[model samples]
Structure formats: structure tokens, C-alpha cells
Target: MSEHLASIFGTEKDRVNCPFYFKIGASRPDIITPGLDSLGNPIPPKQLQQHFGDLYEDLFEELSKYGEIESLNICDNLADHMVGNVYVQFSEEEHASNAFKNLTGRFYAGRPIIVDFSPVKDFREATCRQYEENICNRGRYCNFMHLKKIGRDLRRHLFGRYRRSYRSRSRSRSRSPYRHKS
Candidate 1:
């Protein structure tokens, strides 16, 4: 069962590019990746996949410096509005804002990383139910967040580091943390 789930959603060693991290980062603030420019890249297919994994891991580690991440999601939707979107949810609103500010004009894969505040608060409420069941006629074009899954190893490392303090941080509520993390 675990293997099946792992195949469906990559494991840490796999480190495939996940769309849900965009949403996790999105709930805190929407970071839309207008373009990855993967089409023009000269790298081989296998190497390209490795690059993507590195990018996802790199992104998670980079965001960690600003604050504790509650969630990190990326969107796999092909829709213009949802493509290549990465969301990082920091434990605190300030951290989100901080990340948003710093990331506003950065470049990834020779493209600009456009970061902004997303209205999404709860991911459960924002996901497409039909999509989850694999009955969505819309497929990858669904407007709702079709969160991509992360690898267990990467997921464990990204999430496990902060397990001890998650409770203490959540108790102190601040303004809606739905904004671009600077």
C-alpha cells in the first residue's frame, strides 16, 4: 500500500517537482511561476528531472531561512493561472511577508519568479474534489488547486525538522497569512 502511494506521489529520494508545495507556499502567498523555460533547455531528459528535484529541494531549504514552513505546495495545473505555481506557508505572517519581499524579483530557469498574496486560506477548501477522485473531466486544466504530491523522504525532512515547535507557533494567531512571502 505504501509503495503504491509512493509511486503515485514521489518519495524523498525521488524528489520530483510537486505542485502542492506551491499551494502551501500559496496559502501563505501565491508564487506563480510564469514559465520554467524548460522547453528551451539543452539538458537531457533524465538530467532535467534531476534539475527539477534539485529545484524543489533547493526552494524548500531557501524558504526555511526566513521562517518555519507549515506547508509547501506546487501546482501542476496547465491552466494559465495555475501553471508552475509554488506556494510556501510560513508559520507566521511576517515570515510570509519576508519571503515575499525577497523573492519578488528573483529568477529561476532564466524566468522571473512572480510572487504575490493568494486568497487561499485552507487547502482542503481550495482543492478540487472531483480531481482527487480521478473523475474530473477537467483533468490538468482544473481551476481549483490540483496539488502535486511530494516525496516521503523530502516530505519528512521538510516537515520533520519543525515538529517540536509547530504547536507553540500555531497558538499565537496573527492576521491572515495569505500573502507573498518576501
Candidate 2:
């Protein structure tokens, strides 16, 4: 039976780490569990994407402490096998190594996250669709991750300065009795 199992499932040595990228398996807030449904079955892909969003700055900042991140892509494809996977690319191999060491067993959102090195060296090459071209017919079922371009002004958004100013403006407007209200 052991030999039969080995034939069906490859040996543990078949799992090897990639050098440049790190793959993170994390919990989705919308899902009751990591990959399984309430009935212990696998969750569907569309439901996974509905709960997935861009990696917030808090996670980005935490990961940055280990090394400079080149790009972070969270897969939202409607494929059962590829949903909720986060790929983080580091600028240096040493940085990737450091992050892998530190984040392997860390918990996020009440679930332990699984981190492993990925074989993907270039995200652009892995993407099935081009942003500007807008020609990907695969839509939700595409195997590749479709990441939105983060603008250059990320620093501004990260610092809360934008929110502070917006709040001040709103407060001043509320103080004015003459302000038009719909």
C-alpha cells in the first residue's frame, strides 16, 4: 500500500523551493477555513476572488522589514487550485531567504500561513493578460494572477497624510451652515 501511495503521490523530495519568489498560502476572511468549505469540501474560485483584494500596507510594511519587495501579487483567479495564493518577489536572494525563514509559520487572520519559495522569476512573463491591451479572454478562470498596477504615490497613501487632510476638509465643511447639502 505504501508503494502504491508513493506511485500516486510523489515523494516529499518532489517539493523544492524556488529561489526568487515566495508563495504564501493565507486564510481568506470570507471563507470559514483556509481551503475547505463549511462541509469540508473545497471552496469555489469565484467565492475566493470576491474575498481577495490587494495586500494592504500593513502586510507590505511587515514584509518589507525583512527585505525590499520588488512586487507582491495575490492570485484571484477563479480556478480552485490557484485562489488565495500570494506571491512576493524580493530584490535580493538574501532578502527572500530572510523572509522565508521569518514568515514560514507565522499566523495571519487567525490562520497559520504557509510560505515557500516560488519558481517564478518575472511576473510580467507569467501574466496571461496585459493590462493596457485588455485582451485576456480567460477572465476568472485564467491560471495566471492579474495584478492591478500600484501607482507611484503609494508613499502618500501609506502615511495617512491624505486621509488626515481629507478629514480636516470635511470637518471644516460641516462647520459651515451655508454649505450645500443634498
Candidate 3:
């Protein structure tokens, strides 16, 4: 192996670290946990967006502690593997590794956190194009990531700071952490 490669990947041949890692958190169907409202009732459609916003904020605040997050995404796809998957892209590989190590023992929303290095080099490939245009024929069951939509105000609050730094980087990765808008 080249010296540069050796230094980057480290001597441990078992694990390889990268700038991106995704956490499989409490996967839900269509971004709602259902019966999340008071008295265990289903959240009203009117308040569903608020509940999702709350979730998005909580995740960003918790995950940002590990590093400077470049992007964070939650998959809205209903497929078993893609559902409610939280993908975090850090500015550096070390940050991603730190998060993986630190988050392993932690729990979120009463569920154990599952963190791992991502093989996904491109979100575009995994993204459902139809969903972007709001014309997804497959709905929630699509194999591609159907990312949830977040309120514009909340998005600015969460990602505005990152945007300035991200502009200097690749535009391919500007999108981060939003909720599924119905």
C-alpha cells in the first residue's frame, strides 16, 4: 500500500474510515412514529410537521457534538434498509470516526443507535428522482431514498452556518437534515 494510503486508512485492516457515516435510528413509516401525540393518540396531520421538526432538531443537536457536520439526512423511504436512516457527512474523516465510536453506546428516542461507515459515495444515485419532483410512483416503498422535507425556517436554522463553508466544497453535498413534508 502507498504511504499516503497507509496513513489515511491506518494499520488496522479491519475498519476503514471515511468522511461520511450513517446511523440507522428509529426507522418509521413515512417519518412519523404514529400515536406520538398525547394519550398515545395518532398525531393530527396539522401537527405532524411540528412533531417532525422537533425530531430533526433533536437529532442535529445531538449529532453535531461529534464534529462539524457537512450534511445530515434522514431517509423517508419505507424499504427496510432505507427507512429512517440518518446519514451524517462530516468535514473530516476523523470526525466521522469519532462519532461512530462515541455514538455506538448511545440511544435515541429509547432506541439503540446503529452507526457505520457508509459505502454510499453518491447520494444522487440513491436518491429517488421522482420524489424530488413530488411525483414518486413508488411512494414510501421506493428503494431510493425519499428524503423528508423540513420547514424553510428550520432548515435555515439548522444548516445556514454550514452553507457558507459548504459552498467552497462540492455542491453535490449541500443538502442536509430536513423533515418529510406531507
Candidate achieving the largest lDDT: 3
What's the lDDT for all of these models?
0.70, 0.61, 0.71
lDDT score of residue 67 within candidate 1 = 90
TM-score-sorted candidate list, best first = 3, 1, 2
Q: Each candidate's root-mean-square deviation in Å?
A: 15.1, 12.6, 12.6
Collision count of model 1: 30
Error of 2 at 71 (Å): 1.7
Clashes of each: 30, 0, 5
Worst 10 residues of 2 by lDDT: 18-27
* TM-score, cand. 2: 0.56
Each prediction's TM-score against the native? 0.63, 0.56, 0.67
After superposing all C-alphas onto the true structure, candidate 2 shows an RMSD in angstroms of: 12.6
Kindly list the per-residue Cα lDDT of model 1 for residues 1-182, writing each as its tens digit: 88866775742223234454344333223434332554644666566556656777888999998898888877767765667878778889999999999988998767788888765678877688888888889987777778777668877877887874655455433444654343
lDDT of 2 by residue, 117-162 (tens): 7766667766655533677788755655666444456645644554
Clashes of 2: 0
Error of 2 at 93 (Å): 1.3
